[model samples]
Target: MSEVTVTVRGEHETRVAPERATIRLSVRAEGSERSPVVEHAMRLTEPVRDSITARKESGVIVDWTSTRLSVRAERPWNNEGKRLAPIYYASIDLTATFIDASDLSIWVSDVSPWDGVEVGSVSWHLTPETNARLEREVASEAVGVAVARARAYATALGLHDVEPVEIADAGLIAPTASAPPAGMAKFRGMVQESGDMTGASMAYEPDAIVITATVEARFVAR
Candidate 1:
């Protein structure tokens, strides 16, 4: 009899509370010339940057990185609907890491109200060491899931035994959008406003971060 093979996929998921918080902010300026816009953006961001720098002294801003500056010219479609005299725009983006979970609200409140500044959603994440450990654990569990399914298939087909012939791995799947925990909805929603807001009434609950692993195994009937 010819050999037969079946491919089965297994998935494993785990939830963990994030250990730290992250916030991204953008500083932008527009003008008729590149130099003027670049200067304006830098000046506008000074106050916000100063606040974070001050926090860094006390460990609130654990880590931060600045992205390269970008400048582009406005597309011209005549004066009626678009560009009048070729406006230029310059902007800088920065991301900050806050290790103290309790300081999330304070950090957001400090940065969101600056002029010409835009705030991104506050996201929570695990440390590098923690993430590595979780990944290993889930991967092993997923393989076990695959093995069980293969054995069940072998029994139904009346095959003597089943053995894995080929195994393919799938990488981790992360959430596309941040999911705010219950009671923190207002805190997250406050990001849309350009003014300082308070969320003292709400309690912070680290949203459970979901990690998923999938594996495909080809099993041969013996």
Candidate 2:
């Protein structure tokens, strides 16, 4: 009878600075009627557009847009009671990109609206250059970790050599954030705050994103 043998697993990690970032901006407005609400909401586009343009000129902003627009009616608590006031709302969103770290920081500070506007959230991303560099570093780290573990296993088994039979390189895992999932509330808020051209504050915070990768290797006992 022939005996079977197996090798243990190994792992390692490497950290690198991120290069690229993606910013998501959302604007909302509301009113009693769709037309009025849309009108007010549309006005927000100007300021938002200006903000993006300014950032772009400074070389901090990459892209901006009023991608979403929604309109809805305000419902009263009591169905039987006469509607006290009809409400309409609309929302606008913008996205800005920056390459330099200092520029990115400045952009975040500048983009924050003190009034009449809401900052949904902000996120950081790894640029292609950073991503590629990290991939190589991580792969090397992983291989080093694997070899270390393999050496330990071989020593325990009193083996002189171990051969790598197969290596599975599972590329990097891009980072992502979870959206509100529903746009109804977002739209409603925009419409409700339509009249307040000054701006409104929203309860949202930027999230940190982490990119990762993994690999699997098959080794043979020699």
Candidate 3:
């Protein structure tokens, strides 16, 4: 009989194969003598850096970075309760980004067994352009969901058309404090893993990226 305010939340999610992968690894050297640790570390790290540079030139690697050498000394007690001489450890951390997941797997397999090389986890993601496009589309779909639900509620109440009053990201509409503007998509979720993109020689495959969007809206229904 009269206009009523309707508030609802909308959500949408989509899964897509990852378009990029970043490999993290470190080159480490430890020796009882302190003077030679840094040299050994540098020597061990050079090949890895060269490989990444070559890949970058050839367009296989999108980007790469290596940290300065880190050196530390530690002394430990022996089994007989006697303290052993100080041991010096040096390490360099490097990360390389690849546009192809198969190439990442190949690079990881090639470097993982090298002396002083420790391969870390791989991060899977979509390019910024791709993510932005998907996020906008997903946000639009979420708005549509909100509209459809509002209409359903009005129809159930023997009402006619519904008009939107306000819309904001999740929590902004009802929260007390001023919340930061959440992106159209909050996070890129890694939901599924498949080896189809990588060949048999590859060490492993990357997980799929999930784009999710949520929104809250208020409407007037009659």
Candidate 1, 2-70: lDDT as tens digits? 456867766677887777777777889998788988989989878878877777888887888778788
Q: After superposition, how far is residue 8 of candidate 3 from its true place, in Å?
A: 1.1
Best by TM-score: 3
In model 2, the runs with Cα more than 4 Å from the true position are 1-4, 78-85, 100-111, 169-212
Model 1 CA deviation exceeding 4 Å by range: 1-7, 31-37, 73-83, 86-88, 154-163, 170-206, 219-222
For candidate 2, lDDT tens digit of each residue in 1-222? 122244443344444444545566566777677887788777766777786787778777665555767667776656777766767667776776656656655554554553235654445556556656665665666666766777677667777577776655432122224222110111111111112223333222223333344445556655
Q: lDDT (CA) for every model shown?
A: 0.69, 0.54, 0.82
Candidate order by TM-score, highest to lowest? 3, 2, 1
Q: Pick the candidate with the highest lDDT.
A: 3
* Candidate 3 local Cα displacement, residue 105, angstroms: 1.8
Give the per-residue lDDT of model 3 (tens digit) for 1-222: 798899987778788988878878889999999779999999999999999999999999998999999999999999999989999999999999899877877887677777888777677788899989988888888888989999999999988989999999888897735333334655554423322332234554666677777778899999
Per-candidate TM-scores read 0.66, 0.68, 0.88
Which run of 10 residues does model 1 get worst, by summed lDDT? 181-190
